[model samples]
Every structure is written in C-alpha cells, then in structure tokens.
Target: MSKFKNLVVNLSLTLGGLFMGVIIGEIGLRVASIEGYQKIGDFVDSAPTSFHTAHPDLGWKLKPGASGEWKGEGASFVRVNSNGLRDDREHTKAKPPNTLRVAVLGDSFTEAIHVPVEQTFWSKLERKLGNCAAVKGRKNVEVLNLGVQGYGTGQQLMMLRKKVWDYNPDIVVLAFFTGNDVINNSPKLEYDLYRPFFVYNASGKLVPDMSFRKLAPLDRNQRAVSFVDRLPSWLVNNSRILQVAKKADLDLKKRQISKDFTVLRANNFNPPKDAVWDNAWRVTEDLIVTMRNEVVQKNADFLLVVVGDPIQVNRDPQRRNKFMQENKIQDLFYPDKRLEKLGNREGFRVLTLAEQFKGYTEKFQVCVHGFDNSVPCGGHWNEIGHRLASIKISQNLCQQLKQSQLPKR
Candidate 1:
C-alpha cells in the first residue's frame, strides 16, 4: 500500500515538473521575441527558407544560390543561380558575343519548380530556337528565365526595370497565366499584403504601391480558423513554444504528404463578377502595356504568351462542357481572347495557347497539367505541358523573327 502511494506521488511530481518546464519555456520564448517562433498566423504562406527570401520591392524572390527539392504535384530538384534565376547556367550582365537573348517572365508557371530546369519551357525554348531560322545569324540563343512564383504582372514590370534590363535581352516573353493574375494584380482582391500592388490614382494613371514593405506584419484574424480552433484558444495564443512546436509538426506532415495539388476554382477562369474584378482586369491590362512600353524603350520585341488554365485544355469534352455550363461561363477562352485583343490593340505580339492546347490534349489524351504524384488533370504544368509550351513558343518566335529582322549583334 505504501509503495502504491509512493508511485502515485512520484508520478504527480514528474507531471508537475513537466508542466512547469513548459510554462518556463513558453515565457522564455515570448521574452526572447524570436521571429517565426512567435504567434500563430504570423508566418502563414511564408516562403520556404531553402527556396525564397523576402525582397524590398517584390516582397519575395528566389534565394540566390539556394538549391532544394521542390515537391508539389510534380517533384524536382530546383537550383537558383547567383542572379536568383531557376537555371543551371550562370549569366553575366552583358550579353555574350553573337548571342540572341530572350528574357521570359511570369509567375509559378514560368518559374516551373514542379519540373527540372532542363525540362522547363524556357530552357527547352532555348534549345529549340537554336535550330530555328530566327537564330541563323546568331551563334547562340540564351533564354533567361526571370520568373518567380506568385508574381503578378506588376511585379514582372518591376523585375524588368530592376533586373532584366541589365542582361540586355533582345526579346522579352511574358507568359501570362490566366488562372489568378487578375486577382494577383489587384490589391482589393488579393489579401496578401506582403507583395507589391499597382493602383489607379485620381488622375487615372497606374501608381506603384510599395506600402506593404512599411506595414506591420499582418495578423491572423483574416485567416480562416482551422483545427487549431479545437485547442484552448487562450493557451494556444499565449504559448509561443506551443506555436513553434505546432508549426514544426505541420511542416513535417506537409513534407511527408507532398502530393497536394492546387486545383483553382472555376471562377478564376471566368469573366468579372463585380467592380473589384473589373478593376483587377483593367489594372492587369495597364500593367501589361507598361511592360510592353518598357521592353519597347529598350528596343526589345515583346511577346505576350497567354497560358491556358488546365480546365481550358481538359481532354474530356464532357467535363469541359459540364464545367462551363455549371459555372454559367459562356467561353472558357474568355481570358485568353481578352488578353490577345489587348496585345493587338497595344501593338505587341500575342500568342494564345488555350485552343491549341485543347486540341493537343484531345489528340494526345495525355496529362499536361499534373503528375503521377498528384491529380492527373490538375495543378501546375507537368513535363508534357512544358514540352508543348516550348514547341509552340519556339515556333511562334521563329515565325515572328522570320517576318521581322533579328536584333543587330
């Protein structure tokens, strides 16, 4: 009986010690005020340290000289060059002798972390263009990928000014993703304030808004409450050690289950529903024109490549028709057509890929947007999609260059 009582007392003491340790650790962490070790929601959607770092103007950029295994719908070992480009080759600010340089810019699709650097559209385009008549006079073709994940058109324009002009690209290709670029450009629509935004002033001109850099770190109030809500809210909120541990656990789980795919909603591909969306579209168009003007000022040819969303290129006609019908969307090609018209009106070349991709998907009946690790028909472009993009973009550029004289060496 004495032994049993002693055992109970010892167990109670051990529990008390653990509880005290936790309290002390929590207090120490709070007092230390270590960044990312703080409260919940402080670092939500924060870029991985291995791949990205915060930028003053662009908000987030690929960490220069960083290499990591990117596991999304598709998996690849991605490396960022010293210039923060996702390329295997290093580039100098000056163009190489007798070489034609093409700078490709866009968001995640152009950055292409889901596939190998060699297999990306821009890399493949470089190789493909080498054989084309477009580079008949040039000894080499260099395609510089200035793509970063989650970049809006506004950010791409900023990138052109800050980084791209240094390389002296003879041509600039803007790979516009119809998926969420409209929302990405609009401050009113995109809630993430870490990135740069362009807004229209009272004078009806596009004004750069870099206010996000000066703003305090956004609070978690905007984030939807998740399973964490099940825990004691006060305890979770107050305990920094607990939040750090929870974040680590979640990170581990995410790494373990890396097959999560980003399947965008139907509305993302549809026409504007309200004035906010209308403004987003207008701002996106203005941003594109701004990019064109910059490229023109540098005496570089600009090609606006309108990338088709997965649904627009779905192989199954029934699925495509059903999605359009259910969504009440008159045309799946609406965004593509609109951007193409903008390019035409603005005197910049446009290449719309949705109709061609739809035909290719129907003919080949192969998955372009996903991988074996993810849904076969959704997410970022797979190897086949990249290959198709390289083929089409190379062909288009070749034809354009054939008609127009190549930039002088």
Candidate 2:
C-alpha cells in the first residue's frame, strides 16, 4: 500500500514539474521577444486578403473578378479582371489591331498589391507609353501587368508557355528578381519545397519539377510549425526569446544555403566553378532561353528586365555594406552582372534597374524601395522607383528599335 502511494506521489510530482516548466518557458519566450515575433511558423493568418488562388499548372494566380480593398503594410484598392489580373480593364485573348500589347511577368514586385493601382510601375509605364505613342503618332500601346506575387522564373516561364501568349502581346517584359529567383530555380533550395522547382538531368539538361530529383518530396516542413510558432499571438508578440530563436533559425538557414548551393562569393562576386552554381546557372539560363524562344515564336519582342535588390542599392553606404557583409557579397550587383552576361551571350537584351535606381537615389537622398525607421524596407519598388524604371525601359526599348532600323550603320 505504501509503495502504491509513493508511486502515485512521484507521478504527481513529475506532472507538476512539467506543467510548471511549460508555464515558465512560455513566460521566458514572451519576455525575450523584444520586438515580438511576426513570421512565426506557417503564418497562416497573416495574409490580409484572398487575392491569390492556387492553380495546378500555374502554381497560383490572382483571383479572377476579385474586387476588394486588400491591405498589406499599406492599403490598396485591388480589382482583378475576368482574366484574373489586377487591371481596371479587361483584356481579350485576341488583341485588337494597331494595339501594341505588352505583358509584364514577375513576382510580388511585379504584382505590387501593396500600393494603389495607379501608382504601380506598370500602370505608370502604360500611361507614359500611351502618351509617348500619341506624341509620335503611333498606334495605341497597352502594357499588361501579368505579374503574380511569389512567382519564380519557372512560373513565369509557365505563364509565358500557357497564358501570356493568349493575349498575343507585341512585347513581353520579364521582371527577374535576382535575389530569391536564383534559389527558386534549384530544387535543393528550401524555398523550392514550398513552390514548384526545377532540376537538371543526367545529360546536364534543365527540367522543371517539384520533386526530389525523380519523386516529389513531402511539403511537411512548409506547413509544420515549431512549438513557439504554435503559441498565441499575445504570447508570441511579447516573447523576445521566441523572436530571437526564430531569427537565429533564419540565420542558420542562410548559412546552410551557402553550404548546399554554390552561392556567389562576396569577395569576388563570381559564381565559383562548382556543381551547385553550374546547375543553378544552367537551369535558370535554360528557362530564359525557352521563354525567349517562345515569345519569338509568338512573334513578340522579348526583353529580360533585371530588377535590383534593395540591399545592393541602398542609399546608405554603411547599411548597404553591412547588408553585403551579412550576405558575404562584395560587388553587390553580382547577380545582375551574371545575368546580363548570359543575356549578352545569348543575344537577348537585358535591362538593369540598378543603375537607374542608384543614380536617382544619389540625388534624392531617399530610398525608392524602402521607408525610414521601424516600417521595414519594402524591397519592392515604390512610386518614384517605378516611374524611373518605366522611363528607363521605355527609353531603352525605343532606342533599341531605332538602332535596329539604322541599316547596320
């Protein structure tokens, strides 16, 4: 009887200890989260709206006929056409005659739902193009924003293959975000697990698949949440410990990324003569080549527009250097140079937004991609940034066309 009683007592004590430890740990996490945790676990409830609808082939898309006031960091009135783009007007699959149609394909930067519709870079460019064409006595010009947030080049290529040609564009502008797009091209990158990924073949060929080489891997990691991520918002918002751990986890992942993939060296900004870098380059280049050929087949002029990362072009030299140090980068625009070189070799025109943004930033003393203080850098181009991008693209396109007409002078 005494033994039984002692056993019961021991079990009770163990349960009590565990219960207390959990409570204490939770409190510790809450106390340590100085700025509070935001991107914990899956962040399922974080999206401000249901603007994106998933597609089997396209991966995801802006909902067709979705009209609402969607809010991210900033509020914007979003209206998706019947064809599922954030355009005020509907576009037909068969473009009207004398209409110079342009299609812009990219990720969130291209979609840019954070700002008002009129302020989006593509919108500004469309208006500018129209006005310019009118001045030149040319036909009507229409620029279509076919960008979807979080789209990788694979998706962009898919868009080109399956959708963009439906509009029968005269020009196709591909907005390539150099930062994440590189990793997104490789199935080995963790980001590839969430979205569709591409891989190279035994013959050193590029193939797009969301699989582990031959088989599709389980996306268990994407939907899985850590113990801390499962906590209530109030606790997470207050827990500095959890926030620190999460940041450490992110830092650790970045470190692992360097090990897993052949990343650009910060010291030289060159992709090392390694297998990972080679695979990534081949995969991405193949996609670009495929896209260019497809656009050409459709009788459209293809332009690879390289978007500069904010860290590479921040107005503050110190902050920019720190960002480079964190990423171990030296040239800052290494990816830009690498892509530009590839485009040049392949006879494709690559227009970089880095020079434009950097030049404008030098004069204004204000950032085009980010705001001041705790607001956090947007990383997406702002109104001023978008306007400049439009001008540069328009000017370059016009110049190239004129040069082509120069009769080999």
Residue pairs with colliding backbones in model 1 are none
Candidate 1 lDDT over 94-151, as tens digits, reads 9999998999999999999999988899999999999987576566999999999989
- Top candidate by TM-score: 1
Q: State candidate 2's TM-score.
A: 0.78
TM-score (all chains, Cα) for each model? 0.81, 0.78
Clashes of each: 0, 10
Tell me the tens digit of each residue's lDDT in model 2 across 160-241: 8788888888889999987677666765554434456666679866666644323222232432334455567676666566
Give the poorly placed runs of model 1, Cα more than 4 Å off.
1-45, 224-265, 406-409
- Show where candidate 2 strays beyond 4 Å: 12-49, 133-135, 202-204, 210-224, 227-274, 325-327, 371-378, 404-409
The candidate that achieves the highest lDDT relative to the unseen native structure: 1
lDDT of candidate 2 at residue 7, scale 0 to 100: 100
